[model samples]
Target: MSAEIIETLRSGRLANLGLLSDDDIQFAEATIKKIVNNGSETIRLVFPDQHGIFRGKTLSVHHLVSVAANGIGFPSSLLLKDTSHRTVFPIWQKQKDAPDYILEGALDVIACPDFRTCVDFNWASNSTLLICDLYQRNGAKIDFSSRQILKNATTSLQLAGYKALFGLEVEFQIFRIIDDALKHDQSQMPPTAIKTENITQGWQYLTETRYGEVEEILEELRQASETMNLGLISTEIEMGPSQFEFTFGVDEALTQADKFLLFRTMVKEICRRRQMHATFMAKPIMPNSAANGWHIHQSIIDLNSGLNAFMASTDLTETSVSSNWIAGLLHCARDCCLLTTPTVNGYKRYQPNQLAPTNVNWGYDNRGVMLRALIFDGDPNCRVENRVAESAANPYFAFASQIMSGLFGLENTLVLQPATINPYDVEATLLPRTLGEAISTFHNSAINRQFFGDDFVDYLTIIKKAEWDRYNSRVSQWEQDEYFNNF
Candidate 1:
């Protein structure tokens, strides 16, 4: 539209930076033009932070070319922040084990947009959206980025001539916003949660009336998801107040991660416009609210034959590939628990007979176990569903942990134990019951040290430990109720 912008685009600054492939440069130019012509005013350049929250800057349409040529600058410390927005790393200290990155004083980092992830947001002021990848100002890839970490984990599988497929069975809650927390005192680190009331009295799970009660809002979300190409398979009423479930069609880990984050953002945006609130918190603080779980259904495909690699082998003497995968998942369940259930509140979901697995064992079609092995003979849809992850877990990191664990099993030729009939009562190890336990297990895990480098493992443990420390410092109402009267 502008002569200056056109000249900048033709200069090939993006190509010169080695940020995009030749094909991506062409696509990026086209996408820029398309966004301008499509009447979008602004494009939000977003990158997922350490907590899986999108954090980035917005650029006017006129600056697209210039910004694309050189990435938008953001604080490198954004990636180092805990959920409370405090930079947990001791950047100010020069101790021997201090992190290698220059993170002090919230220094600058660059976010390079990925043209392939561009999506038109017809709902948000008719704007375009593109997710970015984090890079240092000097152009080095940021190792702590959740997306990059996941990509690194998948490289081993990709080189081994296999591709992973992941399906989503995530649950969340929606409430009508009674208070938006706009008052000055409400604003704080992490902010006070808005006051909300449930849209439906949701005791009858999957009943027709339960769905019909909130069908209008649900349809709006479904249609918005379709527009963004998020692959929404179905929506169902979950078994708690204002709780719901969304199942997505299977796709590769990267695509699924992008789709899920976008979907979560879309739901919040849409609900906000309608004076409602949507939360993916593992367990929202409400009376009798059921916790949400993110059940990841994973399977591998043979790159040569394009067949499901998890299918049970017909041979009697040889253990099935599915069994080995199960064994690996169980072995690493404790180590990876921090990734799958990151929040202090998330571990509350691990209870027996709640359709959330409490123990590290596999079972056939049983929802009570951590890994549910579903291998129908001759059925190509066979896969294992890991029920250990909470809905609030970062999708990229969660999937990466799974892929890494399964690869460990396949590489080591580990043998699977017999499937469990009594998932809770069995002698198998129980999942970490608290955030503190999860962090300790993850920090001491050899598998984590091997799969994710020591730097990353330490980085993650430090941030999570910060969160746990904050939790421990606060005295809850339960503590007051139990101690004050007795003391």
Candidate 2:
């Protein structure tokens, strides 16, 4: 805020924060100046946590140049919090078991601007928002940060001479607000779930009239997505009450993940403004409620030939590279289930005959199997769509799991089984039935340890297990109804 502080920051205050390239430093300097000259009032410095939620600080325009130069400081405990806002790690103890944590006593973690990810938040009155990367005081990247983990996976693919492109077909629900818990006591850590009523009677399944009812809100979302560069392809009414699906065009895995989070946050904020509630929860507990799934369509590009690497030949006799990827996905699906469906509620969507995959199998353009191959012999757009993911997943972790698993299959030259015609009846392993099972599978996975390192795997397991423990401790209505009176 002071001239002396600005002068000190501009004169290399962030030089010791990390190893920023000259180009990056220059970009930050110029961007700050541009924002100042544009009369921007605020700058939001945000970082994606393990749950892919954006948490950060807002700076007055006067402090932009100084804060951008020095890097914004935030408590590292933000990364330690679970979905319930509980700090899972034992920070008070010696913490020798958790070495990755530098946040004992809630120490400061530096957040530096990712210059490439700067966006003007036009919906928020043109305030600039810069996505940040977390670092220790010594400049080491936070290994467990969801964005960094995704970057690691993408980098591995780059080294393997391939590029991954991902598209999204994510389904969610929207309802008219009945009541928002605004009482002081209701402002608990995770916040109380707001009560909502159906926007439509549903079950119409993409009918014209069903779409027309919510056309205005859908259009508003589509336009806002365009403003944020979300590459939206289509929006339609899904089968269940107040359910909707949105499709996005293909992009590199990292960019798609960022866009997906942004889209989710944007939709929720916009809907709230309209006195409606939009949720990406996999399966909201209601009578006859349909499950929401996030189907990711992916393909790899050959760096050498600049062609779709999955296409082996038009003859259709030999096994294509894509098949190997599918094999890997199936082989690793169980172990990686925690990454794709991280929450307890997510596992509830994987039910038989529910338009959600329950087994580890692939099929030719079949939606029932976990992996649906839409490959044509000569089509450049041929790709595989993974249907195992839930709408509530952190896109970064989910995409990272896909890349790592597929890479393993490709590298090992794994053989594929015949496509299953009846996905439910096939002799295949069922996916994990609960979050606890998924965490156990992930923890003991040799392939996961080999790729993600034991530290990363263990770090995830500890936090997720805490959530599971909380759930298990609760007394459910089902238990109460069956035992409360009878027992």
Candidate 3:
């Protein structure tokens, strides 16, 4: 068993191992010394589910031998589900067609762990951690795997001789704990709370005093993040009261998504411990409060020469490859709306005077436009900023969609329309008006189906439709007041 485990670790096919028991850790150490004679007690196994949530069970160093003997088991339905915990697909329906199929049985899937993300599991009840990839019973890769999806998109770019780098700027609202009163009475109407600051106002944009007010909370968050190995860049006070923005250093797609999920979990847990609340809802409040957006900054690098592809030449005015990349992003703005601003509430942030883009356009260093080209002439590390995405978007899916759309643009040499002087007044293309409109556009888009694969496209659509139906079935206060009196 030790020999087999050592062979698997040395193969380099699996980068990380998971947490194990004390006995398992000892066995793994012996095996490692025998194989390479240099034992390192570390492993990481991570599995990202349909909602892009990382769920996994880790092993200790001694358990590596036993883990190699038999793979860990996880629920098969995790892949074929939606956010509501409903199984979106008819897995059993296919079994009837193929009598040999036996999916109703608790499907056993293998978790191929990655070693690169291996780190200490100090946050867990047990000291174990590992990042794993899902493989089918037949050893085929799971189609709905979020990591695989991002990997596929990145591979496509690599084939085109370019590598992509991702930076995430996430905004979320924080609320202080008050009485246990319901903010909304579902039986009647959702009540709104008036703004009253327990602390002083006028502290904005990383002000020293602002950090002082929230020092204890922010300090706890920073410590938790550091302990968990989450690469947090900085945190700042946002426009709304108690709203905050957290930034992280740029990384690969999968790593960035993993880090983002970790950050969210850390913030929520730490806030709960401190008797506070955090929400990523795009527009938690309407009429007055500022809307939150997740600004994704991405740059492509050349694999061969290790040069930034989005960089401009010494002469700034000359059109460079970076311009074409920005053009690609702007060209696919409308079609990519479903992935970026996914939820129904996300559209509320796209209003004309909301400081969010209402038109499909790009401009140099412009925040109003959907795409912002942030590269200067002779700057080798230039990149583009996509401001269209809402904070509620699934990072993996959103980033993957952008990669595919941008790749398509690059492949076809898509030309971008000139930057709008006034994006609000420009007669440029508009994003879908509603969830139904976005769904219809996505369903009808052959290009989208082709890139995302028909199975994935169909499954996602079905799940989204379920959510939409649920929302549509609900009665609103406006409907009650207008119709109850008249009819």
Best by TM-score: 1
Displacement of the residue 280 alpha carbon in candidate 1, Å: 0.8
Give the Cα lDDT of each candidate: 0.85, 0.85, 0.68
Candidate 1 deviant stretches above 4 angstroms: 1-14, 95-98, 312-318
Q: What clash pairs does model 2 have?
A: none
After superposing candidate 3, which stretches have Cα over 4 Å from the reference?
1-46, 57-65, 95-106, 123-126, 177-205, 285-289, 313-319
How do the candidates rank by TM-score, highest first?
Answer: 1, 2, 3
Candidate 2 segments whose C-alpha is farther than 4 A from its true place: 1-18, 33-39, 314-317
TM-score against truth, every candidate = 0.96, 0.94, 0.82
Q: Could you give me the TM-score of model 1 versus the true structure?
A: 0.96
Candidate 2 vs candidate 3: which has greater lDDT? 2
Give the per-residue lDDT of model 3 (tens digit) for 1-487. Answer: 5555555544432223333344544454453444233243444356777665677765555665445444566777666655556665566556332222223554767776544455444443434455676776555666657777777888888899887889988888766666435456622322333332232253365677777888777777777778767778887877766778888888878888777776776577566566676767788753345688999999888788788876534222345566567666766666667778777788878888766888887777887878877777677657888989888787777888888878877787766566666767756788777777777777677777778786666666766776677668889888999999999
Cα-lDDT of candidate 2: 0.85
Error of 2 at 486 (Å): 2.7
Candidate 3 lDDT (Cα, 0 to 1): 0.68
Least accurate 10 contiguous residues by lDDT in model 1: 312-321
